[model samples]
Target: MAAQGLSGFYGSVFRRSITVQVLIRTRDHRVLLLRNGNAWELPGGVVKGGEDPRSAARRVARATLDPGSDVGRVLVLDYVQGSQRQGQAQGQGQGDSIAFLFDGGVLSTSVSAFTGAGGEREARFVPLMDWSGGTDEGHGRRWGAAVEALELGTVVELVNGEPASAGPVPAPLPRRMMPPLEGFSGILGH
Candidate 1:
């Protein structure tokens, strides 16, 4: 009985809501923002149980944006503290929430192909300069950091929509040197 109770306690403690958000853009630098009622946000959905973040992002993008959209590398990791007022948001459990933001490479086709493609009620390309007006303050901050990270080819980690005091960035890995050719002889050799 004690063991079962302990397991339940830990299970509840570890339960958290994980969501995947994609940053899709057009050639003109406009971003794709989905309208969820009055709120505007990136195209994505809650990561299903046992589903990897990348896969979830792609899946959500296909369902939310264009089917040909390719989800790229992760750009931002936003961890938000759960609030009682926002109970049972995104998924089960009322614990903290973690959002994975991925780069959804520039759309090559016309924007008309994506708008209302896959049950997405409404979606529009919003200019970067006007992103602040499309979403809430926290979302605006996170999106700004994500855009900066994408431009710098780096990743940004956030805690509650604020940049965490992460230590110095680590140096990139050294390039691998080519191996010497085998069984090669000098042309001047007699």
Candidate 2:
């Protein structure tokens, strides 16, 4: 009876969706990441309405790197949840979001293009080994919970069951700069 009820519940309101994060690795072995205030994270955006997750991932990859580029197949489905933040007032009553993680290898052109940008604000890659050495309490708790739920093995997992990665790594980049898509809001609006 419980299984049947769950099936019905899911059937009535559950909507399938996807989000993608591209982990671009540079020629120097640095992993491309974004810093928003204080959190370090992969570059990605929510999958748009009516769009496939793979297509959305590809689109995000291009937007973060270049207008014309291709993103490869998924490396991992990190997490799926109703809300990333619960204590925050803004996170109240949101629906769901799924974060997809991918392995990105540098395209020769992208490397030169990023390098040419020439500014501290411009995109650059960080060595994964080095990234693993940093710590940020809040960022770790937030991103860590989602990562744990997704079951993806990330540096965040190194900590002793912490909700997010704790290290000196920079903050995650702002979401406003990310592409507009269905689940970008972090909270699902019914």
Candidate 2 per-residue lDDT, tens place, 118-183, comes to 444345566645655225443344333433433454433222223333443588886665566765
C-alpha TM-score for every candidate: 0.73, 0.52
Best by lDDT: 1
Query: Cα miss at 53, model 1 (Å)?
Result: 0.3
Worst 10 residues of 2 by lDDT: 155-164
lDDT for 85 in candidate 2 is 34
**What is the lDDT of every predicted structure here?**
0.78, 0.54
Q: Write the per-residue lDDT of candidate 1 for residues 35-130, one digit (tens) a residue.
A: 789887888788998999999999988877557756999999989876531334554556678889999888754563344755657787877777
Worst 10 residues of 1 by lDDT: 83-92
